[model samples]
Target chain A: MHDARYGWSSVHRCPSRHSDGERPRPARPGGGLTVPTIETRGLTKSFGDVDAVLDLDLTIEAGEVFGFLGPNGAGKSTTINLLLDYIRPTSGSVEVFGMDAQRHPAKIRERVGVLPEGYGFDDPLTGREYLDWAIGTKDADDDPAALLDLVSLTDDAGRMAADYSKGMQQRLAFAMALVDDPDLLILDEPSTGLDPNGVRTMRENVADVAADGTTVFFSSHHLAEVEAVCDRVGVMNEGELVAVDSIDGLRDTVGGHAAIELECATPPTELGVEALDGVVDVAVEDHTLTVTCVDPGRKIDVVTHVAERADVVDILSTTVSLETLFNELTEGGREGGGETTAEVAQ
Target chain B: MSIDSVLSKDLTSVRRSGALWGVAVCLTMLATMVAYVNIGRGAPPLREAQDAYGLLAGLVGVLVPIVAIVASYMSITGERASGGIKFLLAFPNTRRDVFAGKLLSRLAVVGVIVLFMFVAATAITVAKYGVLPVGVAVGVFAVSLVYAWAFVALSVAFSSATASRSQAIAAAVGSYFLLVILNLTFRFSQVVRLVYDTILGLGENPHLYAAADYVSPYIAYQKAANLVYPAAMERQVFRLPEEARETLPVYLTDEFSLVVFAAWLVVPLALGYLRFQRSDLQ
Candidate 1:
């Protein structure tokens, strides 16, 4: 059931006739409510002489799986801190669910489940006891066992948290963050210390939660995980937001020019692929012709020329992967017009 | 929302701590031995009561402050150092809520320990002596609790004032010595007064010791206890040389002592609350 208490209406997703003989109509997304889940403008924070976050303008839409990507000391944690109001920004503004984050932190937090970085458990508490305490504070209806089951910690629910392994601790904390059925989940490195299987499970759980109209703002250094899950990625480096784009869009923008590989029946005489237009770094090996095309429109011309000499057995096109794009974007992002590349996805 | 969950979690953790229980037990045994010394040695009796009760009051003055210090010295800083305060702040809680909740938790821990020990001592004294100075015993216990609260507030204040748990511990222990040996501050204050007089050509200052009395919560606790049961206190103190004690400071009255105790209770906690709310919790 969609509860109106969560900023939704009873008429959500249903066609209904209005008063004064208005025609029947379908409900809007969230009953005409399309507020961005989170928005920031010129958000900057400085610690002493070092700026932890600088002039960051960002927006995440409702139900969007936004991945916050940055390396160590890239101000990832500091940006999360500013969003959670753990520390005030030096200048600029932040809004979560259309409410000022600094001024209405309690209200924002009430609807936002968070797994913050460097957090610790009250060690003496058993997993169940700790979750019970969390549920009490969140004022949510939850069974401790049910939450522990979600993280596959039901067997260890009675064990003291001090005795839990690092992976187990992470799972327990994740379970605790789910207690509120939050509208927005702020996860900072939630997959840290998890094994491969646990990471897969966590990815599925995040997908499940986000499917229920919840927006997830996930931060992590795990590029593979981000690539596997995020609808859009926001890259930050040295206190500056370098870029925000869909995975394919980022690949296209950052050295994702097409590469063509051709397998010919016979070695072509005077292949001279480099002499052809839009081709660079041409290499020939094992009776195969490989070249990169900065101008994709010329790929057919190159292939036609190759076919005229010898029967082309196979032809393949490939673009850069997200991992390659991530490295290049972060390594020399500023030198590559990174500022203008950041797109606000509201 | 209420911070009852934080308080309950704190209390449960405190209850399950064996080290804290060990400290409480050792203090209780020490109180028992002090009571035995009073009774077995047949120390002189105060008017209508045994001086043993006064010994208990002295024991509270000497020992309960330690319990108070131990109970809360790391309350906030410990959480901060462990990054647990972040979890609280990440929820629907403010720093002010943590402050109030932690203060209540510290009070509950110290209150249980001190009250239990005081009751056990009262029972032991009653068993040894024919009559219990139920009135004076209860009155002194009340003042001792107030004195304990003073330390609690001071401990929490210093805990909140610092970011490092180790630094909070050092400051709390240092304050314990300073509050116990409060006369050191008075003596130091006297030196300042003497230097000022010499520099300004204003000589012959006589009441410097009176000003020093405010440095020690121990002194305030004892004075408050004695004022409540003057007969027992008088019985112990009249033994001093007439001239040696005759020059006691005017501020050494029960009213002044109570005022000092109240200051200890209010000033540190008030300052801590302000500093805590003003700080940028990282």
Candidate 2:
């Protein structure tokens, strides 16, 4: 399990593992079989009359980069806190590495690295000192200078962490989370205070770690970031897991199609494009033929059929982006009308 | 190992706090000046040195609790308020480790200050009296250290039980007023007398007033310090009437005051840990 050779390829052998819900365990580099990195069953947490997280059942496989997407106050941080056993669940159970999270918190945390949300460094210790203490507590021999270099904070290692800017503190926290080569890296809002460059670097670092067989579970509301790196993303709204699927899977589930606009020399009149497979709609206006397809791959077929009928001049195509799908999912749930959202999830 | 890491880190962070240093400097000066003034008045007899030690003990009994409360009242609640406890617990450390480490580190700080005060006082005594009473000095140091620990434990207990810094500060300050200030000014005993004689109509009961006075930690410290240096009780903060002192019960003895100190040290810590362990830390 500690060997680096059990990379992403081994886990990708079963791409449909998450969908099926009960697949065989993956074999690690040392011939050891390991369970999912995280699993929650009927997990619920409530504060008085409000339910922060309600009946959440999530499973993140090893070597998979799972993105937890939700708006502010949508229970993303509460879910992460439950997984870390920072708070008790009102009902239900959470297991990490096949062990009960509440009962074996220390043992689970020994293998997990976390960048908790809203964390602060009020101590007078420098950035380097904070990293050193983290490494020592984990009983791992991580070089503080190397970790600082990874976050591009080596120059500021001597400065007090409490005095650092918000962005710099976020970077330092990310570096600290990278210590001990953790089996599971849980980042709650890791991109909260990052600039464009820092965000790019963070995305790359996440990709790099997941490639090396580290199960990366990160929570963020940034759709583009989730679309960039996650194998599967879970959408949460109002303490409920509204949807969980790959970006393409979500697009397909929402029945969002691609519209290919063909700017022909003249509009096609009777191309018989309506009869083509996967074509949802076809319209013509002012020398442009717009063909909408449920499956984007049918764009080639639509264009071929249109070329036979008219002189094609240009082609412009647009697929449904994750942003549209995310808005559709979360907005439906947020409007207090969860019926439409539940149908889409199903 | 986790506890050790937390202990060392807290020690490093708390030692740099200006409040602790300010209290330390004041305590050292108080100890030195008390010794210098009393002994420099000429060696009339051996009783002079004992009187100086008694006065120093009285002053320390008052100051040590202040230092301890200041050093520890924010040990847990401050971190919770600033969100620093999240960072500390993000590693593999358990809640037990965090509680134990914070208690021990703050106690260690107060212990060092109490030791320094005694050492400076001992230095002055040797310089003026031409001889050192090592047994008395060590006994006073031991009793003062325990006294300091009791207050530190109580303050840390408050810090652990409270979720906010303001709440912890209120509890610590309230305890100091009730335990140290009221007891020192004899107001606590007066209230007890009023409740027993006036409110309850039980007539004058000096024994109950004496017991009420000793409930305060500083008064218990004086009673315990009397065990080491008998003359220390001659200048008691609240002197019982002659009739009451003649037939003192077991609970009023100097040794029983050690039991009061022990209760102060243990009960609050246990209760605080119970509350902290069950809290959500949201």
Predicted complex 1: CAPRI docking category = medium
lDDT, residue B268, candidate 2 = 95
Which ranges in model 1 have alpha carbons more than 4 Å from their true place?
A1-33, A255-318, A332-346, B39-50, B182-186, B198-201, B232-252
- Candidate 2 Cα errors over 4 Å, as ranges: A1-33, A257-319, A336-346, B39-45, B231-239
In Å, residue A177's CA in model 1 sits off its true spot by 0.6
Candidate 1 lDDT over A1-346, as tens digits, reads 1222222222111112122222222222565556688899999999999999999999987666788998888888998988888888899999998889878887887889888888877647888887887888888898888888889999999999868988898898889888888888989998999999999888878876765656788998777777666667899988999788866567667453566889888865567766775554466787788765665676888898888778899998776456645664566444543332332110
Error (Å) of candidate 2 at residue B109 is 0.7
Clashing pairs in 2: none
Quote the B-chain TM-score, candidate 2: 0.94
Q: iRMS of each prediction in angstroms?
A: 1.6, 0.9
lDDT of 1 by residue, B1-282 (tens): 546767887888888889899988987787777776774444544332446667777777767877898889889988888888877887787777788889999987888778877777777777766667777877877887888999999999988888897899898889878777544234444554667577666764545534564457776776677777856354322123456457665575555778888899889999988888766677
DockQ agreement of candidate 1 with the native complex: 0.50
Instruction: Show the lowest summed lDDT stretch of 10 residues, model 2 chain A.
Output: A1-10
Candidate 1 positional error at B236, Å:
11
TM-score of decoy 1? 0.82
Q: How many residue pairs clash in model 2?
A: 0
